[model samples]
Target chain A: MAVEITVKGEVMTALLSGEIDHHSAAGMREKIDSAIDSNMPSLLVLDFGGVSFMDSSGIGLVMGRYRTLQKLGANLHITGASPQIEKVMKLAGMNRLATIN
Target chain B: MKIVNKFNMSLYARSANEGFARSCISAFASQLDPTLEELNDIKTAVSEAVTNCIVHAYKEKLGKIYITAEIIEGGILRIKIRDTGCGIENIELALTPLYTTVGGERAGLGFAVMQSFMDSIKVSSKVGKGTTVTMKKKISPRITVNG
Candidate 1:
């Protein structure tokens, strides 16, 4: 999936499309890491409305991001996830780590 | 019996999981009314289990991972994933939600994901020997479409 970033003040929004699996993790890591480092956003929002499929690869990616944000004491939110993607997000207990909208 | 005619593959721990196992599994799975959704389930299950061995089981060490697949007579596909590495200290504890050796936001969802994706999942582990996971899924009946 492709990730597009929109930086709004201290909040960075990540718009994702396609599938988020192992194949897509590298790109995600690079994009999210760069956004976090360069923007130093107070919050990171992952928008998954356009994503068609996701699996544990997506979970691992989000968890890695959550860890990075945790270390920085920043907030994270996920929005617009499809039912399948949302099922995975909820299964990963992302609700405890980040806001789900 | 054709039980012995199954597909056997043994791959190095480092190379086995690079998403290759998942791809192979998808290739071998029956295509009766199968969709991208079924393929995703199989891939995700294979990815999580194989990844556990590659990323967590060996940790910093090197080892081998074994994967076997068989298509049964009743349209059931069985996959076995095995690794010879440090086993779980406590199988029950390890399977607990929110518990993971990786820590630091691991979220302990690998097993959960595997369980959710596969029709049936079984795990066996020995303290210092290794862990084995058996997953089974059945192919749906054929669908007919006409103009």
Candidate 2:
């Protein structure tokens, strides 16, 4: 998996691609958390448009980031999830933790 | 049910193998002519099961993960993932949604995801022996018009 981060004003967007599993998620989490720590943007957006596959590891990634951003007074926004990924996130109650689109 | 086709493989319990396992199972299941959604569901379920073996089963040590995929009668795909590592002490608690023994980035939703995607799932374990997760999903046969 790969993560590309961009910052615009107070918004930071992370564009993730490739299959996300336990192996790949560790790298993604470290990169995103480092960005969040340094930038501390008011909003963090996770773009899943390029992600072809994801399991519950994706949910843990989002939940962890949400918790980190929440402590920093930032909000998390998830977008571009496909139908299948969206279903997994919703089933895990991710909608209540972040803004999913 | 009669078995149409089947394959078995054994791999080391490592995180990197998670993707490899998913790809292998999905490729094997392709003979069923499952839809993209069905294929994705199978891949996701397989990932969760393998992840559990890697993350929880062999947490402190490395072991072997055995997998068997069989296409049975009626367009059903059955997958069994077995680990000879540390087995779960309580199967019921482990299957509960969001209940995880490990802390940090684990959401503990593996079993939940497996149950949601697969038509049926059976998990059996002995604390010292090992754990086995057998999941099955039925792929509806598609109709085609031949000219």
Candidate 3:
């Protein structure tokens, strides 16, 4: 899996690609967290357009990021998630934690 | 249900193998000509089962994870994932949604996801012996239009 970070104004977007499982989630979390720590953006956007597959690990990844951003008093937005990915997120009650589109 | 085709594979219980297990099952289930959603549901269920083996069963140690996939009668697919590692002490508590023993790192949704995606799931484990997760899903038959 790969995570690409792009910043615009107060928004930091992390574009994620490839299959996300337990092994890959750690790296993605690290990259996103480091960016959040360094830039401290007012909003963090996770782009899942390129992600082909995901499981509950994807839910954990999003939950962890939400917690991290919450501590920093930043907002979180998830975009480009396919219907399948969105279903898993919704099953985990992720919609209550962040804005999903 | 009668089995049409089946395959067995064994791999080390590593997080990286989660994808491998999913691919193997997906390829095997493809013979059923499942819809995209059906195929994805099977793959997702397989991923969750394998992840449980790697995370909860084996923990920090490496162990073998055995997977079996069978295409049954009437376009039904059955997958069994077995791990000979530390088994669950309480299956009831483990199956609860959003319950994880590993603290904040894991979402504890593995079994929940499997149960949701598969038509039915059966889990049996012995504290020291190991754990096995068997899941089944029926792929609806698609009607093709003749040209």
In order, the TM-score of chain B in each prediction is: 0.88, 0.97, 0.97
| Better by lDDT, candidate 3 or 2 | 2
Determine the C-alpha RMSD for candidate 2 after optimal superposition of all C-alphas.
Answer: 1.0
Each model's DockQ score: 0.39, 0.90, 0.85
- Give the number of the best model, judged by DockQ: 2
Question: Which digits, one per residue and each the tens of the lDDT, describe model 2 over residues A1-101?
Answer: 89999999999999999888888999999999999988989999999999988899999999999888888889999999998889889889988888899
Weakest lDDT window of 10 consecutive positions for candidate 2 chain B: B53-62
Per-residue alpha-carbon lDDT of candidate 3 for residues B74-99, written as tens digits (9 for 90 to 100) = 98898999999999999999999988
Clash pairs for candidate 2: none
iRMSD (Å), candidate 3 = 0.8
Report residue B141 deviation for candidate 2 (angstroms).
Answer: 0.2
**Interface RMSD of candidate 2?**
0.7
DockQ value of candidate 3: 0.85
Docking class of 3: high
TM-score of each: 0.79, 0.98, 0.98
Give the clash total for candidate 2. 0
Kindly report which residue stretches of model 1 are placed more than 4 angstroms away from their true locations once superposed. A1-4, A15-27, A48-53, A64-75, A79-84, A95-101, B1-5
True contacts kept of each: 0.31, 0.91, 0.80
